[model samples]
Target chain A: MHETALTQNLINIACRALEGKGVTKVNSVTLCVGALSGVLYDAMEFAFDAMKQGTVLETADLDFEELPVTARCRDCAYEYNPVGFPYICPVCGGRYFEIIGGEEVYIKNIDCIGDDDVVTD
Target chain B: MSQIKVNTDLKALNNEIAAQNKEKLHSCGILTVDVLGSPGSGKTTLLENILPELAAKCRVAVIEGDLATENDARRIEKTGVKAVQINTNGGCHLDAKMIERQFEKIDLENTDVLVIENVGNLVCPVSFALGEDLRIVVLSTAEGEDKPLKYPTAMLKTDAVVVSKTDIAEYVCVSTDKLIGNIGTVNPDVKIFTAGKTDGEYRAEGLVEYILEARKNLK
Candidate 1:
């Protein structure tokens, strides 16, 4: 349900960006979904599929890029991606750290089809 | 075909409004805090216990965000302070836009502290900024100690982590020390405190004191 609201924001962005571009339809929207952003890819795509209509993004396909959790250890300042379970620093075996990445959720680009039957990336 | 670089933060517009809301609240001398936790995690109960103590020091107002019902709002109002409820009506979390609209219902002139009780969810609320000065996540002991590990964003982004319902810690498998250790794994700087357990009339005092201490961070 949260994804639905967030996906609306993405759709709005596409609409606003292509407002005066003479674009007939949106081909796709590329998004970066961070692991810590708590956005579900499938859920967001489902939302976009259902909600995109009567707008520039009516036919838009959502392309997602999954970003892994990246953090730096506090004890040893070791940067590593903690995959699963036992989150520990690979270099110094430190258990404590702060997440520095994989928290951003944003739109990267918009691919659309212009009025002249030309597809724009 | 031309490719346009949107490269825009999806939350940029919302954050802009949130920054504006923060300034508006601060200019009115109101300190805002977002209280977050999972469903049935004793968030309302903790507030009920501490509202008097907090109100005694400053005029407190609550903005309750829930998927449905004005239940939390009614509960907060019983404490004899201003309360407004925003029913998300199926939304999982409260965003800045919702807060911006509902905040106007509460009088900013007399309000010294504004506590926004975020919708019950460990996942989505972390992504939305509600123009708050601080964020507190109340983790009930019954919710398991692995919560901090599972929802690291909620713990890391929050200013404080309150372990609520410690009186029943004996009934639960999670130990207090391990819970604190798990919190350190994500955010070592987050203030951790045990609260919401009492034998005689002073329930949630620790949590109240913790919240009062956080007032120093307010502008």
Candidate 2:
């Protein structure tokens, strides 16, 4: 899986967050990437290997929550998931449907030892 | 015996940076214009005509992103504005971090407009957001009418579209109506600007007018 720059960007951002809060060893990593966000999960993991090398986020477990494309029809207010590309409402077949969600790319939380841990030389 | 729950996703960090970049641009009262298109789309010609005029009215600057070379930046600087060349060195797109770093190198406090000439690719540039207020997609008449429909991502993300090389539209067999129709299918509201660099009867003038209008709207 060749990581796109987008995934690498996410990894770089995560690394900064980890370092900022003094997260030496991350217990788990969870992300919510929307279908429309155009983020590839496999590529993200591929980038994590090289991007996190020699960093505090070296061995963090990367978890991803894939978001589906949900749309609300403008004509009939019908909400539904996209069956395929060229997203259109199934019930009303509305050409224009506002994107309600599934573009989220953020961390919910992290388990890390706050600086009050064992002494380090 | 204890249990810990750590849910850290690094992607949020980039998103935060993107937000911060947007906030900075917003506070400056400047509109970050992202110019995206395929190779040889006459993006340079459009800028060459518009930048000097825009700079005369308001403080303007450019952040040029490309696979390599300062060619586009060099071209824009001739119009008498600070053009910072960001050579991506084969990268397909420009991300928020790249734009954020460019901000440090240039001053946008008094600047009224920030034009980002993104790498010439119709696909990848749409995937990355550089915190721009508006994304402009340029297509030359020489590129054909089916361009927008084939590269839907670029059209979908664009706030405006410019059909360049309009003077050569007849020779190239590029139908203006068909091109507009394709763009309309994807983005019905996007303003379309027809432009070129022919001496007297050029459409470049109208394009500059649109840029001015965009500036006023951003303000």
Candidate 3:
């Protein structure tokens, strides 16, 4: 029940999509998460399992697309992806940079079952 | 059968809360700074010493996150400023939702500086974001010089590193030089400071000055 709120939100969104599309059950839910998003995948999964127990997504699968942290240099305007922490500009060696990409955590898509067949929504 | 359709990202709710908190902080031009460190690393002591110095110049608000006890909050309140203690119960790190809730209780407009003291753990706290202007990690000499290398994540994400307990550096075999070198290896640009006891009082002028200078740089 710790992630009840989060789980409720997830189920609400997923259930709506399922019913709207005339799908009887939701097979899985997919998400795209950036490395810098600061989300605990394990915790989210645990919360999902606990939260979806009695809902329409009781047995839905959760998929994740992990993205890396990418930034652009302020000095040279060079763009690059940072592998680990202590981000620096790859081109100009400038410490100052803007995070132009990564840090994305969103619902990329979902999968559902319509009538008696599997479908992607 | 009528079908009901809804397309929503569940995480959006949390993100919305985070955005509101960000806007509130932005309107006031106040920067939220997070202080992270391991247990027994002299984090509270460093803050206690610097609070009065910083508070004298600007209105500072503190959000202290701990597994238990409001003791740190009490200590910070003695500085004659606003302090809120967030008890995480058993959570290892302080998440944005918790901070978003805390932001509601503080008047961000009057606050010039906001300091969030993260739960005492180098590993977990590094992975969690609390929307801070700068993330400073505190390491004490007693914790050994290899701490930065051992807990590379904390050092890697930090904008600065504070080496505390320099007052007893000679008594302990902690290689301050080696520690600085290792820290530079992981994060070359991270501002480093050493706070130790000098003469009759603890001298942390460098660290204090860094904070003051940082506040001026904030937009």
Instruction: Please compute DockQ, using alpha carbons, for every candidate against the native two-chain complex.
Output: 0.49, 0.22, 0.27
| C-alpha TM-scores of all predictions | 0.90, 0.73, 0.75
Ranking of all predicted structures according to lDDT, beginning with the best and ending with the worst? 1, 3, 2
Residues A1-121, candidate 1, lDDT per residue (tens digit)? 4788888788788788887778766678889888888888889888889888777788778899888888889899988888864568899888777779888888988877676754344
Q: What is the C-alpha RMSD of each candidate to the true structure, in Å?
A: 2.6, 5.5, 4.7
Each prediction's whole-model lDDT (CA) = 0.83, 0.73, 0.76
| Local accuracy of candidate 2 as per-residue lDDT tens digits, A1-121 | 1145655655565565555454457655566776656566776777766676776667776777787767777789898877544566788777776667665565555445545543221
True A-B contacts kept by model 1: 0.57
lDDT score of residue B4 within candidate 1: 57
Q: Candidate 1 docking: what grade?
A: acceptable
The residue ranges of model 3 lying beyond 4 angstroms of the native Cα positions read A1-19, A33-47, A69-106, A115-121, B1-15, B103-109, B127-131, B142-153, B168-173
Error of 2 at B8 (Å): 6.9
Q: Name the runs in model 1 displaced over 4 angstroms.
A: A72-98, A115-121, B200-202
lDDT by residue for model 3 over B1-219, one digit each (tens)?
Answer: 222333354557655665666677878988778899998888888888888988998889999999999999999898787899999998777877899888778988799889999889877677556777788898988888777767765776788999888878768987788888878866676799887788968767677667777778886
Please provide TM-scores computed only on chain A for all of the candidate models, following their numbering.
0.84, 0.70, 0.80
Report clash pairs, candidate 3: A20-B4
Model 1, span B1-219: residue lDDT tens: 445568777788889899999999998988899999999988888888789889998889999999999999999889887789999888899999999997669889988889999999988898899899889998988988788888888987898888888888778877877888888776777888777557755475466666676665665
Candidate No. with top DockQ = 1
* Candidate chain B TM-scores, in order: 0.94, 0.89, 0.89
Q: Between candidates 1 and 2, name the one with more favorable lDDT.
A: 1
Find the candidate with the highest lDDT and give its number. 1
Candidate with best TM-score: 1
